[model samples]
Target: MRNNKEVNAVQATKTADYCLAIIRGRYPSLAPAEQKAAFFILEHPESAAEMTSVQLAAAAGVSESTVVKCCQRLGFTGFSQLKLALVRELATSREGAFGEVEPGDDVPTICDKIFTATLQAVEDTAKVLDPCEVALAAEAIFKARRIFFFGVGSSAVVAQDAQLKFMRIGMTAHSYLDTHAQLTQAALLAPDDAAVVITYSGRTREATDVIELARECGA
Candidate 1:
């Protein structure tokens, strides 16, 4: 028979996975202020789980109301519920899928860990995606006259790959490695154009500039 501790561990794992999946899946659609709070929770789930709404808002450089709204957007009742979910998730993650490699680990062990982490990431993403949002985004892209992809550092590689794929399908797509070129392209975007900003962390100045300019130009 399972002990109380084992049962609690399993429950925590399930709750944590659900909470994290929601945050990841809805992140792109959140407002800039709400995204700030959500990104903080994603990057510091353990710390965020322990913080009050005001404290989390301060840490994330957003307002307290933003934090509350972010929680609501994720389908939580309030900050308290979000905190509870994060706390449970952190409890189960202490040595779970996100575990880091130790110096003494073998190559096979490292490979296994990498594969496990990759699988877990994919599973979490699959859980939180909203079908409506996906369909809307797909339809927008399908109808766009041109598409602009923006990114920096490693994300730029992804942007370039996307640009190549779209071009292969006979769509006009652009991805610039230069910041100046990106801004220039963004300024020329019309209402019929679409822009996709790709970044691991949503706080980069370059990405913010591109998004703002693209929106201003009615992309």
Candidate 2:
């Protein structure tokens, strides 16, 4: 229940930049339809920012509700709010050069430009990532006696990645891919335990169910 009352122009820019970073990190975990919506947002952000849910859905080859749901998964209230955030980003961004590359420019030149742009984006993300957030998350990890991570499909891969990272650091962590196994593990967690549910779209029913189970089990 975070509010945007304290968000100014700079904070808005940071939020937009962080949104892009999250999209990059989480894209592989999204469904095919959801990924299509994500690409539409990134590839044509200006146009997508101005679009209504229906218009965005048509452009992304998805349902209007699906487009709206994607926005929600990204922590937006709805399409209008998400669109406003993107528009703010467009306002702060530098304009690209108008000229198209000639055929003689070579593939390497194009590759270099793309790589440089991505590097710049990563740098921008680094500027906005809150050190305090990571510290708090670390504290949460340290305080919890047992940790359960849940994901499905590609998100399952991310869950396993987190599990391995924690285990290597000499922490207690478990990742579950199957619903039944997830329930069993969740039931074993005590009140002092915690669960990290990783779902890019946040609409995966099986994963959500596991989260609910963990909550009920006092995790």
Candidate 3:
């Protein structure tokens, strides 16, 4: 069993990682000043959580309004709300919130860590996902004349699996592992088609290109 200080430290680390993940997901779309503020928060989540809006702005070399705008862009109401969220996360985080396998771990330990990590991922996704948006996406897919799935790297494998499943359900679905092939398919997409772009980091160049082409084609 760990003492209070140790537990608090672990929770703070977990919260920081979670907050960083959110910021990173939104990094590509943020404005320059907002991105700078986000970068600072990513590098120093604990310190950012404790700092005032003005202090964080000075530290990130941005204006105070930029910090507040960054927080809002990150889905928070303001800097104060972002700070509150960080504090809440730190307080509510459980032990082993992010399970990691250590070297020389036995079979059972490895299995436990893997399973814990999976559960944590699912829970975190649930926390951020919007049910209304999911419903809209599902509706769009259902109404589409065809579906185009675009991805690269490991996400390409997932796109292929999605294609197979959609095909099994008697839907016209296409996915290509090659970047050129993906762009070609995207270019052929009609206005009635639906395109699903998958990327783990949300910053994959190939995935972005595919989405751009699909959108240009009115998919």
Please tell me which predicted candidate would have the highest lDDT against the true structure. 1
Of 2 and 3, the candidate ahead on TM-score is 3
What is the clash count for each candidate, in the order shown?
0, 0, 0
lDDT (CA) per prediction: 0.82, 0.73, 0.79
Clashes of 3: 0
Question: Model 2 over residues 66-97: C-alpha lDDT tens digits?
Answer: 88777766666788877776776668774232
Q: In angstroms, give how far residue 175 of model 1 lies from its true place.
A: 0.9
Worst lDDT 10-window in candidate 1? 92-101
- Clash pairs, model 1 backbone: none
TM-score of 1: 0.64
Candidate 1: tens digits of C-alpha lDDT, residues 112-151: 9888768767878665554556788888899999988999
- Per-candidate TM-scores read 0.64, 0.57, 0.66
Return whichever of 1 and 2 wins on TM-score: 1
Candidate 1 Cα RMSD after full superposition onto the native fold (Å): 10.6
Q: What's the ranking of the predictions by lDDT, best on top? A: 1, 3, 2
